[model samples]
Target: MPIKTTKKVTNKKVVKEETKPAVEAKKEEVKTAEVKKATKPAVEIKKEEVKPAETKKAPAKKATTKKAAKPAVEAKKEEVKPAEVKKAPAKKATTKKAAKPAVEAKKEEVKPAEKKKATAKKTTKKATTKTTTTKKVTTKKMTKEEQYAKLSLDTCLDLAKAMSMNVTRDSIIQQLILNPDVKSVSKDLVNKYQLTGKFNFEEDGYDEGLVEVLVSKVYETADIKPQKAEDLQADVDHALNYKFTDVVADGEEYKAQFDTMRKVLMIAQHKDIHDSKNLDEEIGIDVEKFVEEFMDLAYSVLKTWKYEDVDYYEHFIYAVLSQLEDLHDTYRNRIMMDVADLYILHGDYGLGDADYGYILRENQIKDYIYYRYASIYEGVDKDKAKQIANQALQFVDDRFTYYPNIIAVLEG
Candidate 1:
């Protein structure tokens, strides 16, 4: 019995020991469960904090993007403003180019106007030149014979005077003969030498003989036969022997008759005295007798003559004076004094008649007379010569151009 008891007790001890170990293990497990619950709550709180921080960071990033977009927009507006300014300058350049074309067009218009004016001037010059050339051509087309034929006897005389040629009857006849028309020549001859009475062919005077000779020569030159020649001869003879009656004494017809006689005498005497080799033989009279007779005849004619043509009488006196100078005879001073007296008387008459040319001719003659007197008295009477020379100086001027000897004496 005792041995059974000891084995059961040992089994009970072993069981108790095993049960204690199991209880301690259960206590430790419960403590570990409680710590795990506390740790789970702390992890949940940390997750909530992380979620709020992430929301704030998202708002900051969106603000930065908005600022960047504002700067880009301002830069784009600045670029657009520069482009607009450049376009305005380009528009101004275009307007300037257009104005240049307008100026050039105006200049072209002015050039055309100037061209028209120049053309007008040129046309006027050409017209004037053409007119002058036509006039010259017409004048050149006329012949000398045609020109002379167109002239009248008066015009011919004027031409002779203008040409400084001698206006003599022979020169006039020569000029008249140049006319081709025979009727004109016949008419001229008839007008110049027509007679009104019978002429004495056997007249004793040299002038009558010379007139007869001149008529004969004219008839011979004309060679007009029968009727015309007879008429001309009869007319000339009548004119030569025309009688001066009291009824026609103051008439133009009587004056013409006296003029014809004087002309015949002067022409014949001058020709015979200047051209004849033997003046006495040609005139059938001594030189002294001829001069005396001519002077008497001229003085008689001058006393009766009351015409404007005093130059005709002057010619007659000058012819006789020239002959006297050639003779150098004792009658020279007397004849010169007579001529001077005649000139003085005529000069006084010319003052009343208002003939300036006659007064000038008288002054010339007086100067000549004084010079001649001075020369003649120079060797004979010194005081008288000096007095005459000083008197001549009063008339000395450009009109004394033909009297160089007179000027020399006056100066000396």
Candidate 2:
């Protein structure tokens, strides 16, 4: 019985050993399954943390997109401002173009008014020029009296037709008689009327009106007694019949004395006194005596006529001196020098005196008179002498050849 129990114990031990290994393997498997469950929970925690980080990243991306969109909007607004600026310039350009046409139209409207003003001014200027031209033309014409005044004394005498049978009641003759330049014409007419009785109304059938006018003019110009027109014919007849005795009581005697004086002058002319050095010895006639007598005769004639018959005295002196014109210059000059010397010595006579008019009518006598006066004034007033000497040279005649010598003496 003991042997059989040993065998059973051995079998039981073997089976226990096998069953212990199996239980260990089963324990390890259970440990592994629990660890796996714990690891799965950790992995799940990490996944949650990762998911939070992804959400923060997503919000950062959205903020960046919004910032980018704001910049785009600002860029679009800036572009719109530039477009509006370009439209403003275009509007200004259109306005300026429209204003230019308006200004041009205003200029066109003013042009015609300016042209009308210019035309009116031109027409007024032309009208003023025409008026001035007409005034100038009117002022150019002279009158008849002015024309006659310009004529010479000889021309006036010729126009009068004096001392001719064709002489009529001419207004020109009356004008000439009244003209102071031809005052001697009155004396000539009177002498002719007295000599030829040409003015006798009934005898010569002369115009009574003309005779009366002639008588009136002669007496009036001589400053003599003015006779009536009715008595002119009787006075003229009486003058003719009595040899001008009605005018002067000693008319014939005065005439004879003039004739004698003329003969003496003729004798002096024939002697050629210019060539004679000793005038007193060569020509028996005394020049000083002759000049004195001639002056005395002139004074006597003037005194007899109450100094009112200047024309008669002038005529007588002219008649006497006219004969000496043909004489040599030397003799004539010597005679005139003597006369000037005598005049200066007298001291009462001036060159302006009417009595000296006939003497001065001869150019040589005038020059000598000036020379004498200048020479006399040279000692007292040198300036006055030079002035007088210079005046002598102003005469336009051939007799003033010695004037330069006188001037040289004055200058010296």
Task: Using TM-score, give the best candidate's number.
Answer: 1
| Local accuracy by lDDT, each model | 0.41, 0.42
* Segments in model 1 whose C-alpha atoms lie over 4 Å from true places: 1-140, 150-277, 307-310, 320-325, 328-332, 347-412
lDDT tens readout by residue for model 1, 20-59:
2223424544353332222223333233234533533432
Cα RMSD for candidates in order:
44.6, 45.3
Model 1 TM-score is 0.26
Model 1: colliding residue pairs: 195-235, 195-239, 196-239, 197-238
By how many angstroms RMSD does model 1 differ from the true structure? 44.6
Question: Residue 40: error of model 2 in Å?
Answer: 99
At residue 200, give the lDDT of candidate 1: 33
Model 1 scores worst on lDDT over the 10 consecutive residues at 70-79
Q: Evaluate residue 172 in candidate 2 and report its C-alpha lDDT on the 0 to 100 scale.
A: 27
What lDDT score is found at residue 340 in candidate 1?
40
